[model samples]
Target: MNVEAPWRGNNLARQIVVLSALSFMIIAAVIGAGAFGNTAVEDQQDGALSTNGSYLAPAGPAFSIWSVIYLGLIAYAIWQALPRQRTNRRQRALGWLIALTMTLNGLWLVTARFGTLFLTVVVIVLLLAALGWTFRVAVRTREPRGGVVDSILIDGVTGLHLGWVTLATVANTAAWLTTIAPASWEKAADAIGIGVLVVVGLIGLAIAWQSSWRLTPALALAWGLSWLAVERFGGEPRSTGIGVMAIIVAAFVLLPPAVIRILRLLRPSVD
Candidate 1:
């Protein structure tokens, strides 16, 4: 796609108006759900993971990253809608996808807040899928030479969203199992959650290596490590060892390549 002309015939103002309006609507819906209460289901879970609490679930802090992700997305949307980028096919597509994902994000917040775990999981799953698609398209649109930096930013956001939601989905499924099934099922649910996390971490490592997605893997690994640490020390006592081990394995796989890349950058050309 051709690079869009700047200022001339740009409809950025209209785009911003629409997006701002949509954002307001989403915020209003979230507020109306009484999701702000201290003891709201999500907040209670967060508190449960606090230093004084005994539970070790990772969903609480991981979800807080959504605020940062959303801000990045909103900025990207506005940038794309700017007169200079409006005609850029990749930018336009990314903007639209971000808007859709943001809408779904709001819905997920509302559902999760109301304790509708299943529906919340479904929404987050879709949002992650959308983010993956957008990242791919954005990377494909980059100029061959300098595009890596842009791709890194886009892919970083996408990978982080994917990684976190994959964990959230597992957590949500466990919540459902614990709520609906016999107490005896808790062990099975925890087992399944840890297993899924391991596989997800492996997949994340594979993507990071294959794409040489350096910065993305760092964020993802940090997220995985923090969660594992939380589980290990936060007192849930169930599968904490497994979670920590998974982080270790993921770090061994994901970090070495990034370090190599950095080393190469620092080395002077022999010429």
Candidate 2:
């Protein structure tokens, strides 16, 4: 059965208005977060972890991906707010979810910066799960327009956010484990962190291979692998060898499908 086109019906204007308001709120929140303070909260067990310092550190620099993700989200919000596009149910739902996830992202940063490491991890995990679900839903929707632009935008943003958070969660968990657990537990934590990366990489590959949502995963995989290389060779030695191996395995597993996708894009249409 054909689904009714929500964008062509009632409430389109209202949806646009709501989306615009949400977009403004998100921008304000981001700005507020930046202006709050630059102080580093001290970890009782391990001196201080400065937000700027930690963020600039090798492992910490990875979080900067969020800046790009947030930019994409803002672009998406603006797209959804366009009066011409507001009636699409898929777009509307995606806009709301993006807004929700962005708020959570900001909160996680605050929590983590303030030394609430465990809570920060929890929020990041939830945000990752929520964004993954959002991407899945967007991928299954019938396009409002006769193109894949909306789906690609929504799913791409979701994939990037989810993929990075998946990695971040492992890093956060590792930090916590090292802090609270015995010295012997450090090895076990490293093992578990590498395992999580492998599992998450496979899950990402499955999503990219099986769905129409290919580009985002391709980009995410590239980003993930690049960081893996940096973390391995650029000074941070947290399971460097194993992490690099996992990145190579993931790249190999994803290469064929990515190549086919590229060829499909380059080939001319027969119609």
Candidate 3:
């Protein structure tokens, strides 16, 4: 049996996808290659991280997650370049949103560089929303026997994207507030930061349960949270409670699927 996606021949999807790649590349260049001589994101943490120095943030090394995420996206870019994938059900649904995300990525970098913390938060929020929609669409369009390509391109790529952006949005919001709000709000900042971490951990639980614990996004979240734990628990300016909370949240986010799979394996199979 042969399945062909009608949208495969659609030029608009291809164009938007290509445009997204260009925008993503720009984001990379700005963040890493010093395009416009901008400082790397980790180095430019002054606007947010350096200012607030929140206990909820991960240590510097944890951010290397971006490199892996970029690699996944590049794999996706190449997959889309194939004529067969142009009209892919998942691709058709996800292409525009992916492009939108890349555009937002660049916008966030600009806002960060200019010290527009509020706008940076706004852009990342939109970016997270776009990725959420993309994930929803990917789930709706999923077909059985979708195989490795489908899993990798549709769920894997989008899941990793969504997970990372979710984590980023929290950090961005914290940064925004810390940069703008008066120092008198320091306690409130800590409360809100910890609150956001809790909420994100719950979101992770939902994703894991919904996906039956598909591992990629959870892994991504865990990676960031683990770093947060390191920062709070082990590093300077530390808070043992927040660091412990990060550890628990990370573990909670990763637990459901493992539990479910164990149950499934224990249940007797039908002949």
Name the candidate, 2 or 3, with the larger TM-score value.
Answer: 3
- Check candidate 2 and list the clashing pairs: 7-87
Candidate RMSDs in Å, in order, are 5.3, 5.3, 4.0
lDDT of 2 by residue, 72-146 (tens): 777776676676665566665565566667667666656665536577668778877777777776777665532
lDDT score for residue 117 of model 3: 59
* lDDT tens readout by residue for model 1, 193-214: 5566566667666655555554
lDDT of 1 at 260: 64
Rank the candidate models, highest TM-score first. Answer: 3, 2, 1
Q: Which portions of model 3 miss their true places by more than 4 Å?
A: 1-9, 12-16, 19-36, 45-47, 50-52, 142-146, 188-192, 261-271
In candidate 1, position 122 carries an lDDT of 74
Q: How would the candidate models be sorted by lDDT, starting from the highest?
A: 3, 2, 1
Question: What's the TM-score of each model vs. the native?
Answer: 0.72, 0.74, 0.83
Identify the superior model by TM-score, candidate 1 or candidate 3: 3
Better of 1 and 2 by TM-score: 2
Computed on alpha carbons, the lDDT of every model, listed in order, comes to 0.55, 0.59, 0.69
